[model samples]
Target: MKGLKVADINKAAGLRLHRRGGEAPAKASQQQPAALSKPGAAATASKNKNKENAASAKPGNNSKAVRLPAVKAKPAVVDVPPAAAAVPATGNAADRCTESLKKKYSEVGDVDNESEDCRDCLLVSAYVKDIFTYLQQLEISAAAVRPDFLQSPSRLQITPRMRTILCDWLVQVHQRFTLLPESLYLTYHIIDAFMSSDAGASVKKSEFQLIGVSAMLLASKYEEIYPPNVADFVYITDQAFTAAEIRATEQRLLKQLNFFLGYPLPIHFLRRYSKVAAATPAVHEAAKYLAELARADYSAAHLPPSGLAAGAFCLARELLPSREGACGGSGWTDALEVFSGYSRQQLEPLVRQIAGLAVRAGDNAKYTAIRKKYSSSSGSMVSTWPELDGTGEALRSAAGLS
Candidate 1:
């Protein structure tokens, strides 16, 4: 919004020009001619002054300055494709509730702090990307939106053992009756987002399916999606998770979360603002990283997905690799201006928790059993449970396929 100043540019160019009260334009000629007439004035001038005089006094010394056309530089506008639209924009009360939830997190203020630029956040975002990449491993394409299938399977060929790990983890997530399927899907989304961002972690073939499932478990309850069916979960794991065991772990997870399941996250708000602002490519990426980091933190048993997303993005503007190039530009600036009412301060604690979770998730070994199971179960088909027949709309809606 600031106007360009010609004087500032001139100063930077280091040209000494008399625009102010340095010397009157005619003062030098007036005094010099009179002074030079005096005997002392002739000798008083230095050799450099004589040279200047000689140069100025030359017959053909002066030449008109050539002027060229001044072309104004215009700002470039980047056209970015919108995030995949949700199944139908038509709103029911439940959809309205989800929208409200998005609004809640949208209110968090962004943090200007760049103090904690580190690999962990990048690693976490990359980790989330890998999970989504792993979804390609599922290789199950529903008839609807196959082309728009935003998630891709793993590029690095995974071992059969690793395959079992993923499936078993999925079962494990399903087994956690306390969590919802929507959260599980969200968890996968976060993992994919993270993994896709980080090249190394995805290449290392780190076992992230377990972490992904755990994070999903955390997200489901928060989103109020389909709660996991404990008995069905046990069946998926072949009774590996007893009712008592699942309940105990759920309790532990709840305690770890300080019993707060209702926290708003980054994805909901990011998508909303991104849509309204038509954010640039860079801010879109920053939002992606923030969203995944937020999701990863949910698995820590410490924070909720919504809280983490809010905090991460609040810090994201400061932390992303392109933060400087991305922030305060038309992209981010426009988004912020429109969504200025939103703040990131409310999510700081969650961001810290997510950063911590990113560290812990990297080292956690709870996925050993789940990974082993996932790898081994590929040849055998997972049993399809009977669903009461319904319209495609209802079915699609239930599976979030709508």
Candidate 2:
């Protein structure tokens, strides 16, 4: 693989930070110091020759200067807790990656044009490789620690429709707070994992909403820098539950899951695979729409995150208009399979399921939340596009499904 620049990689991977840099530059004031344009002229002119002589004549001047007590400024108040005191002051992974890229560029200064591009490509490849390796480890760990549906069939009160409804509501809540995609995925994982546990078998249907919101709350805290407050969650619920009830439910859900909330999410896999495919924004949006739709359906729960991501990516490619060199060929599919550890054949069934889900979300009113969300301009309006119907059938045919 050719080395790519970090800026280019960031753009391709959708990790570009949209935020403005720290405080705006201070404006220049009209008032000027007396020494303007004449270096040290004001200070030199202000000095008294007599005072200098008088100070030099004093024999105890050195002792007096030394005797002056050192004054110290008080430390500024930091909002961080003592437990997080040991954390590095440096920013997140993306920021660190950018800094490393800058350092590499500086060190390679004035190199031949061709060599510089090659070196940049190599540096980018190395950075991406490191990130992919870390995600691979996480994928393995997530599979190992993933919660199982151990409860007897009779004990499972939460039906598929109920799960779908909960997920739909969560989508609205997620949008209301403008939470990160990771938070939404984590919320789903947390809720499902808790419900599948032994303790969650006895939870009443009335408490389902509370459990769902609490899961989202925990996910936000884990994935967001400024997570929404519990009161905000309560308000989103139209004050159906009190702050105390929500907190209590949060504790219960956490205990049921044994505090294992770090499971790998489909979004994580989607990011990596999309980069490998070099998918366009439209395709990426379509893929995300399919993935989010999967969250609402119980059938998707059986599929692992890796399989889900591959399926969504496959569907996204099909949905996009056919352009020369635009779609992933055999090599691309093989690369995704190797990276995600799921062959095309293995991913086909999930792909079909996701396609069906996407179609239904558009055609059916019950699944309208997800469809409506994707219809908005801010969402890229991927859901409202007319290509889904024909593309879905094509995806099904290609997947060897009826």
Candidate 3:
């Protein structure tokens, strides 16, 4: 399954922001309940009619929908043009997976499953569920850092505030390079995971920023198609550490963590949960903003990436005018409960915690990188949302972070 990309979400929200003048987000595309599709002359006629309607759609409409082949029919062969093959494009992973699921389980057609646009894409491998399960188990392994790792005896020099400063700086570096969101999240995870391991005990205060830069180097190598050259990373730091030092620190970080970099991120969880909840673009964008904010807070260490993602999503629905008409009447659904493994009761405190962080994000003077990053038009100026403009009971209780 494809995960939702930060860029895509931002672009989607940017469209709504400019077009709707920031009114409640227009409803996500929804599919209606339909009788079982059958293969026959009538079905064929109906399919042709739908095709004609789709063909006549206005510019920027999201579909160029094609008819699905009849069951057990011999498929026709088509010759692909060289240019079409060279220009690779497919829906994001979540969209493709949602499309696959929708075909198998059309009963939920009344909901916006987020798959309609990728109707022509191929389905993923059958073991994808097993992959998610394996990653979930990995989330608990020794590869992860403990909460309050800065207070541990092995790493005495680094402070929570120091880590916060480093992370905030890295967010700016990430945007300056226009790196993927996975790289940003993974870069910080590498730093924390390395710090937790005994090998990193020797790391000094002078080398702290070096460790951060190296972690980004390593993460970009893992996540980017064309990572920045070592020279670019070196220059980004004003050559404080030479390219050689960065390469050395990257090796140190990976060796300390036993080269484990595939730990799932909150963005991963948010994408899946958003579809399950039928969350609107606005709600999903809010969740994305909160999840990214979680990357910088030491307090967020208390929640696993999945829980952090789940919390952001749950709170977003509450904070925003929700998708009441989408699926299961708006709030947390039984389907979400089953898939996310989070109940309404379990999520309340977490929601408030993330909400507190999201609501007050712009107020913090010391660390404003994330807030500034989201305030731009590409982010749809999400940091300035009126929904987050108040201090409600949710923000009042157990005052905390995203």
Candidate 4:
């Protein structure tokens, strides 16, 4: 971790102070410093000035001049919460992977070249491929966690339609809280896991919504930077589920999941595949809409996250008019096949399923939350496209998938 530098916060005469050479810059006294006309003049001047300056500038130096907290500042009235527990100084596996991504991208080619924009971010992490590899392994177990609860004769209280309704309502709660994308996906996974497990046997028909709200609260705490409080969650439920009920159910749900919160989401796979195609912003958003739209679908629950991601990306490419020559003007290409590890033929079925969901999104009032949410300006209104009415050949082909 990098320590805060006092020099960064305390500027002297709109000029940076030098903690070196036992003297300030001759230009420091000047109201306006002379402009450097020559290339590397700043570097040349910095080298000639002082060695002590470099030592002071380095993070964690013992110099009092460099310590940020040592300097005094005015205080303000603010509600101070209790001190949080000590955060680990060392990086976790995810942290380590992100740190590695901060390195420069040195590979050649248009695909690699385009990704230079996201260099030094987790989007282009070096370990991204390996991370997804582990996620793929992890998803196998997660898939089994959600049994055929819809088809199970033993679970009579919850119906497939009820699951869809709960998911739709949860989407509204998710947007209301402005939670992360993972929280929405994880919430659904928790709901599915709990609904299918032995814990689901005790659920009454009236308690289904309670379970949805509680699962989302648990997911928000796990994924959000600052999750909403239990009171906020209760308020979102119209006070139907009290804070006590939500907290208690959260505890039960966590135990039922055996504390395993991580699930391989379709969005995770779509990111990698989107990079491969060099997909446009509209296309990427459309893919996300499709993938998220699938969450309301109980049938897609049995499908792999990667397939859903790949299919969504492929279908998005078809739905939106292409401005670039992505994938050689084809929906699927050799690079896509190599990266996604799925063939065009393999994606056809899932593409049809996703397309039907999109086509019926508006007409189906039961699933209107997703469509209406996407139709908003914040989502770029991808759902409002007239093409989704099924008049477009792309949508029709995707729907038929013959």
Candidate 5:
């Protein structure tokens, strides 16, 4: 929800620029009193010259000078083309948007410098507010048409473990492409949306991988600046799926969802609330680990993205050392509740589920990809932190669990 409304915000900002451009001519006209004064002065001078010429003609005996009429230069009309007039204003607006994006991406966490910190906070807040409104509308529309997994015909053949395996594979694909985190979450959403639809009811087990890959491809196209080609996906899967098949599946998936791909994802909320909490890199990494774990678990499909993000953040904070100068005050839960729109009681169940998934991921061999992925240095090795295992009881207690 936080990042979903970027398009709408951008449109509004552009409109504001156009409106300012339209007003520029009016302001310039108001400042041109000299134009009006120049015309009056010219008329007065012309009248005096005409009178003198007439007097000279009447009294002149041998004066043969021809009196030429003084023609006032018509006021120069400088016509400004609409396109040219709007160019500078549009450029200025674009520059501001670009700067905002640079600032948004440059700072991953809290800023220590006072002025720079405040600027970053304002940029992020404005961005999130716009996105939140857009996401609310999307949620309302998506809910009306959302498929019911419980009654889905595909649920008969597709087991939860199968879904986990497909999702785990998707995680690997996502990393390979270096896609945005939102892409992976949207990929899962697409897969789930398709599975719960009538079209996916008759899909064969052999074709499951095809569905997963197609979903990822579509999500990439939607969220990525440059999405990978169908061949790339086929190659990634070792040619288990051909390009033609992938394209066809893409069309099917699109038709099923009515081409509405923008859904509020957990990553969107996680990034916002993490900033609100002023979480450290380690806390963020740990939280991401938990969130991804939840992604791979089929049971988490029913949980709202915001709740899942809050749960992951709560667990992440419990797993890491507290920051000395965190801005969220002494009560991290309160900050999270306010920023994430979920109370502690509402977040407790989700937190418990996420924590349970974290614990199980460490113990289960089948779920090794996520654990191993996070164990690498690139992930900050947050998965291997001792506090993850050591703080189980504390985390449970904090979540209001027995």
Candidate 6:
């Protein structure tokens, strides 16, 4: 998985940009290094290929070439607060042990009894939320210092239909991972957020796929305790992308964001908050539902992924176990209440909407017809896993995305 090279992705993007700039084919070849001078290279030359396609397909006159402004890199520790300071933690050693025992006992009774996992899962959710809140505050400050750093487009420049198609494609790629729904959401948020600013025009639509892939790679490591290896990442895609290409793209994405890999996500914060509150099983379930829902929709992409996540946790607690009965529980609920503006009533509908989407997420046959149009090729650039068809089904059968 560590196989991707930064220079190659820069070269790839540079090559595409040069082609768009009308550099002659022969001259372009001369500019490339020996590594790309192979006889068959022309067949996969992204720059020239896009140039020809863009010329023949669209006759637009936007002669003013746009340069991507250099963005200031985020600090090594921008969004993360020292773990010691982020939360007023409760539960000394014994209480934690007790909770762990309870969860373990529940699990032994039935793995499918999600009610048991809720305690542990909510703990994980709280960590995700803490990180997210820290990230959100840091992201805001970072953007204030350098407005272009995290700016991006509100929507993909492509047609509305294309946007839907793009999301469908994302679902296919996500299937290959192991319990990385949060990672998928993070990847989507990063690309969508980064493109919101002027930096977007510098990137081509084809480049978007690579960005998504790289973000997923980074997110997997951050979220999953045991992430798939580079080979697994490549393997999961079923060879749609060569290991070399995926590796290269991963590096490029890192460079583009200046390696803000540690930026927090919402899942982290939610788990922590839930625990301190001693949330009931149902409230914890509702929080998980909100996080998953927030991840699947693009509109949710605009909010700092963490803020939306924290809000979800807050909302879930309010809705579940009856808000009136939750007062004496834990400090977690009180703390979350202060941070998230939403009340239980406000989030109920959104929660339902997300629940519906989660159920439908695995219903691939409905979107199969639309997805086929974009998945037309099996070249080194595109992933070709046949298992792509069963991803949604597998997700449904595996813990129901909660």
For every model shown, the clashing-pair count is: 42, 3, 3, 0, 1, 26
375, model 6: CA deviation in Å? 26
The global Cα lDDT (0 to 1) of model 1 is: 0.37
Error of 6 at 141 (Å): 2.5
| lDDT, candidate 2, 1-402, per-residue tens | 111122332232232222223566799888875657887766776687667868877987763544678899999542211111111112233322233334433443312232334367654643453454455445444533223353344547666677777787677767756779999988888877777666667877788888888999999889887777776665566567799998999899877766878777889778777765556787888888888888667766745676677788877776665621454453235444433444456565777788777666656865577788888998898777775633456644544545
lDDT of 4 by residue, 1-402 (tens): 011122322221123221212444467554787787997988988886778687777879876654456767879532111100111112223422221222211122234334664477655555555576667656764534454775685756788888887787777766655667888988888888787787787888778887887888788878876677776655555556678888888999988888888888878888878787777888888888999988668877766677788888888886675533444545776556555456577687888898988776756765677887788998988887765644566786678733
Q: List where candidate 1 sits over 4 angstroms from the true fold.
A: 1-181, 185-232, 241-266, 276-307, 317-325, 329-402
Report lDDT (Cα) of residue 159, candidate 6.
36
Model 6 gets an lDDT of: 0.47
| Best prediction by lDDT | 4
Q: How many pairs in model 4 have backbone atoms within 3 A of each other, for residues 3 or more apart or on separate chains, i.e. clashes?
A: 0
Question: Looking at candidate 1, what is the lDDT of residue 187?
Answer: 49
Off by over 4 Å in 4: 1-124, 143-147, 153-155, 323-329
lDDT of 6 by residue, 203-281 (tens): 6655555555666767766666665456655544444467788788777666666766555556655655564455665
Between candidates 3 and 6, the lDDT winner:
3
For every model shown, what is its TM-score relative to the native structure? Answer: 0.28, 0.64, 0.67, 0.69, 0.66, 0.46
Query: Over the stretch 1-402, how does candidate 5's per-residue lDDT look in tens digits?
Result: 011122332332332221111223444444544465465888899899999888877855567778899999999442311111111111232332233333332343222222254466656643454465455335444732233473454345767777777777677666656667888888888888788777767777788888888998899888876677776766666556689999999999999888888787878777777776767787887888889888767777766676677788876775565532443422245434433444455566777788777766766876466777788898888777765642466554544554
| TM-score, structure 3 vs. true | 0.67
Tell me how far the alpha carbon of residue 98 in candidate 6 is from the true structure, in angstroms, after superposition.
Answer: 36
Model 6 TM: 0.46
Alpha-carbon runs more than 4 Å astray in model 5: 1-124, 143-155, 323-331, 389-402
Q: State the lDDT at 372 in candidate 4.
A: 79
lDDT of 5 at 224: 74
Candidate 4: minimum summed lDDT over ten consecutive residues — where? 80-89
